[model samples]
Target: MTRWDAVRVRQGLVDSCCSAEQAGDQALRRGRPREARRHYERMLAEAIRLAEQFPDLSTRRDLTLAFNKYGAFWVGAHRLDQAAEAYAEGLAVATRLREENPDDIRLLRDLRFGEFTLGEIARQTGGPAGRRTAHDHCTTALALAEHLVGTDPHHTGDRRELGVVQERLGLLATERQELDEAAEWYARALSVRRELAAELPGDPRARRDLGVQYERLGDLALRRRDLEAARAHYDESLSLRRSLLGDDPRDLSTQRDLSVVCERLGDVALLTDGPEQARQWYDDSFAILDAAFGPKHPDTRTLRKKLRGHPVTPN
Candidate 1:
């Protein structure tokens, strides 16, 4: 079958789920966690039912995608345990596929993605023990990603995966308080992401990844109390995120990112511009999040608490 035909077939296999997943994603971006979770659960159930009923390649791939999306949704909601479980489920499926088709690049890539995601969740919740587990998973993921890139240097997806692995290594190093090592890994990730963005200027995702690397660098600088460096990095990240938002105003995730950078800018303003300036920054951050996710969302609530000392202008 042609690639387009295969895509259509896959869509048909998962059509019952497409609307639920889309609704879930929209709710997630809008910051309604409960609603998003409900929709995602329905989507996952549908995916699982279809996969079990058919047990075909396309259906299995759809199932894997559902699990991965579920994991991502949980990660955004800060439900690390759920994220881990979902990722583990996806990993199991991917592993089975890889074992059956050792030479299939797509299956291998899926397996690598699963490993990397589980590693990330582990790093977030497993504490020191989790970090170790994350390190091992990331290391293996990096090796697989490298092999894939070497096999197909022109494949942008493989190259992007390599960059993602490097960024994870940077995060692991930061968790260990290995500043120099963290910087080294972050620099490598930035280099790769920048190259990809330059090559594909129209690729918003590539630009977003580049923004993420800058934000990571900004975070590391903040931890080190390097305010100037943090400010510069965050400014760059904000600019990119703003451009992305301008390009797609309906993207709630991008809107959330604007809130994040605004909060960071608030931090810097607090340190450099005193109470009034800081309040303005914080207010901007809170307003964006409040509009998207409502005032009761955990993130919006947390930002509200941060604004406690300041007089909040009514939205």
Candidate 2:
């Protein structure tokens, strides 16, 4: 092939990857995880091929992004193992890229994003050791985020990431039973998110980030068995989520998030009110999930189990 033809061919592959990733994102937003997976697979395959053939900066960057996005999708689908594997792959690629371009802000952020994601997955995997590893990884990411923010105080992306890192650090502290430290981190993150959300009220991503801070606080309160505090935080989260859902009811990802808040509220209700009140909350969650993923899906099935057995939630 002529050099011109080769360039065109590679460009075509890159275009295909871009389209596949967009399609995957759309599918995920609409609550069609299975459909999203197919598009993500296509995007990942093209990205890998491009990197293998070219091994150029652009190609490698695309490869890392593909893995990271796929990892995010797996996280939404509640597949921690798949999420971890994808994040690890992204980290491996991003580590080399960051070393080569230490001054490149985007590359540095990519590496930190990978580390941050892997840290969350480590916690989800569950164990004393896992929590310790998560704490270390997140602490490293927190320092990096702080450096990024310090370098460019006005950089919105850096600030946003800093908030997310703080949120995770708060969760890690909560795991270690350091409630005071956790509250401090959560407060810092909340302030950052409030700024971002106020700056971009129409941006769903910004609003969701803010909502997540409240949700994390709610989870912490529940851990303390403070039902009233948990309910208040969850109510705030649910309000933000509901507003987002109202903007786009067809968004499955948002629906899932709403369901989580609803279910958590149900946990609070079960403790405070009774089975009947909690049942109503559970039904609300079930309705959303059943509509989004059908009753046979694992999420719905787990909800059903909760309804039937009413197992005592440790939280």
Candidate 3:
């Protein structure tokens, strides 16, 4: 093609990408998944066309960004497989660009997020090899995020990302029955989130994460048969979650987790003290679960059955 023709194609591709991105943003803001997906797909196509027309470092970076945005959209839609594939493609492009321009911090951060997403996918799928890969990817992402934070301590985004990565790592460890390691990682993540919450008092995400970490720590303690520690963590988690989420439906998970912990604590009391104390604790747990999940919910039914001398599935 002639130089003018090539320039026109590149400009057209850029315009299409810009327009598609605006549409995608608007669709996402309006909570229209299908519309957002269409716009992002169009942007991805235009980005590929631009890369072909001008196969330069800058065009490659743009393509990477497009893929990253597409991946993010997929993630929001809960399409883990598609998100992983998009992130993988973006990572490859970003790695190549990073080799040419090593100082491009944004590319580096994108690569880290891609790796983190890949790790999350592997963890969700589950398997020994997948778990190992997830752990490795999380470790690398955490290190990268930590480095970013060290370079600029006020980089709240990086710090938040690091805390999330740590929390995921802790969860993976917990799944593998590595209670000690899980507790340690969860504590570290919780510390970072607490600091973040203090700095950005209005941000609910940080507070929510800290509450989740406390819940995880409580689970780990319970698994280790440390009733006192478990109770403390559970109480803290429940208090924090209640303060933040109140009685909103969004707090169901936290409510369920607290109920489980309460039930477990009752079991411990039964083994340690007398039946009366255990019954009181069990009743408290049952009341909470019944109120939040209703009498016919699995948890409430199981608890009721247990009280009636039937086999109950451990929470």
lDDT tens readout by residue for model 3, 1-315:
999998888888899999999999999999898999999999999999889878898788899889989988988888878988998899899888878888778877877887888898878768898899899889888887887788789988889998999989999998898877888899899899889988987776777777777777877887888878877887777677666656465677767766775676677677566676777777878888898889989889988888776233334
| Backbone collisions counted per model | 0, 0, 0
Cα-based lDDT at residue 34, candidate 1: 95
User: Could you give candidate 1's per-residue lDDT for residues 98-183 as a string of tens digits?
Assistant: 77777888877888888898898888785799999999999989999999989998899999989999999999999899989999
Show where candidate 2 strays beyond 4 Å: 1-101, 309-315
Off by over 4 Å in 3: 1-11, 18-40, 54-59, 72-80, 246-315
- Best-to-worst order by TM-score is 3, 1, 2
Per-residue lDDT of candidate 2, residues 128-206 (tens digit): 9899889888998988899899999988889999999999889888878999899899999999999999988888899
Residue-level lDDT for 134 in candidate 3: 93
144, model 1: CA deviation in Å?
A: 0.8
Which ten contiguous residues of candidate 2 have the minimum total lDDT?
306-315
Better of 1 and 2 by TM-score: 1
Model 1, runs deviating above 4 Å = 1-101, 310-315
Best by lDDT: 2
